[model samples]
Target: MTANPVYEFTEREQHILKLLVDHYIEQGTPVGSRTLSRLPGIDISAASVRNVMGDLEHMGLLKSPHTSSGRVPTSAAFRVFVDKLLDVKPPEKGTIEHIRTLLDPSLNDQALVKIASNYLSNFTRMAGMVTVPRREEKPLQQVEFLPLSDQRVLVILIISDDDVQNRIIHVQRNYSKDELAEFARELNEVYLGRPLAEVRDRMRKDLERTREDMGNSMQRMIDVAGQVFGPDEAEDNEDSMLMAGESNLLGHADLGDVSKLRDLFNAFQQKRDIFHLLERCVSADGVQIFIGRESGYDALGECSVVTAPYEINGKLLGVLGVVGPKRMSYAQVIPVVDVTSKLLSAALNMRN
Candidate 1:
């Protein structure tokens, strides 16, 4: 399924290839020259059509499956179709409004992400996915420290009215309630309203410069702060993506192989590989499409992944997209993904 380099096609070659690919996509079967010859816009005899199809097969754009005399467009053909031939169909105005209504701005970010995933699946009849927004981007609203027994402290981080995170960190020694309160007060004064990522970096620098000069109590407080403010390993280990309609892929004929479906479902359940794939698209601008074998995962070798990064105020948050057979309607699916990303971004922006 590795891609072949693009080859120059004559006007007749492009026309015949487009007709064959379109028919195969619609019918989900090999296309014969006889069928292609009769298709609209193809004013060629069956013999002439077969000759052109032979040329296409020689160029690695089409292949004849052993079970059938007809031909199927190879991945290379799809690549050329999307890149040079496909005319993308934009969603209608009503479709835009419908997506907007579904992605209501009043809903919280998590709820919005779920709705987006579900909508993509429902609309495309394919597996849909959205990455959970990064936790460190939220602005800090407040911080609190409560002393616990055996040299441990409960650190509470308030990110917003609705978002709060709790972490328990072990300290070198226990401190009085008043000392803990003082430490919280000083940290809040310096780091309040900053993003958690920024606060973590600044805290690291502060600890480095002040460690030798500060008293033991202050040094201990800084040590506890370092532990508390560092990246959450637990959160990192948890799945950062939300997926919907993975079972929908079961209905796609091309992906019906039991072993292939099993591996695909397992990849969905494990999520690490897919999440990393989406992460690569985070830095890409606008929509990114990965055809068969382009995704670099064996389970996805028969699938096409269409993704677009969603953001707020021009800052990227995460990626969202659909996964389906390579024969998917790129003309429709492309705009659907593009518009979903925009609507999701708008909904999140309303929250901020």
Candidate 2:
């Protein structure tokens, strides 16, 4: 639909709709009139509530599942509730401190990956996941060459934002470690702190113009560098991919259907899809929420994502986000995700 339809509701209808959505989200079961009447100040007969619920179902706001005699909110009902009724609260101060304190300062990248995933898992009480940040937009921070064989050199790249990338380039002829060191120094002086997108093309033009007369090894080194470090132009194949937390969304009661859950998981598995999603996330600074079917991913049509972009010194570097059932506690998760993204940026910027 192009726009959410405005449903004209009486005070009772509004109260009943909110109650049904809240109860369903909490219990993951159809809500019956009797259960709703027990709420404070309801002051309504079971028959009256049932009549209003039937009207809601007819208006496409609720559904009665086959296995139960109660009603549950449909995607449309949830969308309406999210748009008009949700009262999101920030995570409590104690909870925020617990999350902050749980992050150990001593972990290396790999260790941090595991620790982060576990930490998020515990905090969300859902699957805690994180994806490694994309390295393509990064600027060159440092480069080193390690000699492994007569002709093989490992090109280590330390990029902006503490991201490290390495590639092995084989020289056609062996050079002394002195030559490698000289080349590394030269490369650093010319390209250090330059954006990666500018790095290769500038070098290629320079090398092609000046080094055409050079030996085959020098030419091949230039060629290999171009091949290995190219920037991604497509939405899919960009720099980011999921690093952890694939299993968390499956536990949401709303995603109990295997087919829908599989589709959601499959979307995360596609590196390009996740990268595009993160790219979109980083395009904005604050928490961005994409509800079910709101995100562009077809597989994610049944889920919602809450993401925040983190930065270093005003430059956008990466994103941290969570995907869960559409019934996610946006009030609680948004601030927590926001704090985590800031922590990540601060930590990375400190390292830099």
Predicted model with the maximum lDDT: 1
Q: Scored by CA lDDT, what does every candidate get?
A: 0.88, 0.70
Worst 10 residues of 1 by lDDT: 230-239
* Candidate achieving the largest TM-score: 1
Model 2 spans > 4 angstroms off = 1-12, 41-55, 104-114, 145-153, 160-164, 170-182, 198-228, 231-253, 261-275
TM-score of each: 0.94, 0.76
lDDT of each residue in 1-352, candidate 1, tens digit only: 2455859999999989888888888899999999998888988799999999999999999999999999999988888888888888879999999999999988888899999999999999999999977667777888899999999999998987667889888988887788889889988998898888899888877677855688887787788888888643445523579999998998999998899899999999888788989988987999999998899999898899999999877778889999999999888899999999999999998987
lDDT of 2: 0.70
List CA RMSD, all candidates: 2.0, 4.5
Clashes of 2: 4
Which ten residues in a row are the worst by lDDT in model 2? 231-240
| Candidate no. 2 TM-score | 0.76
Number of colliding residue pairs in each model: 0, 4
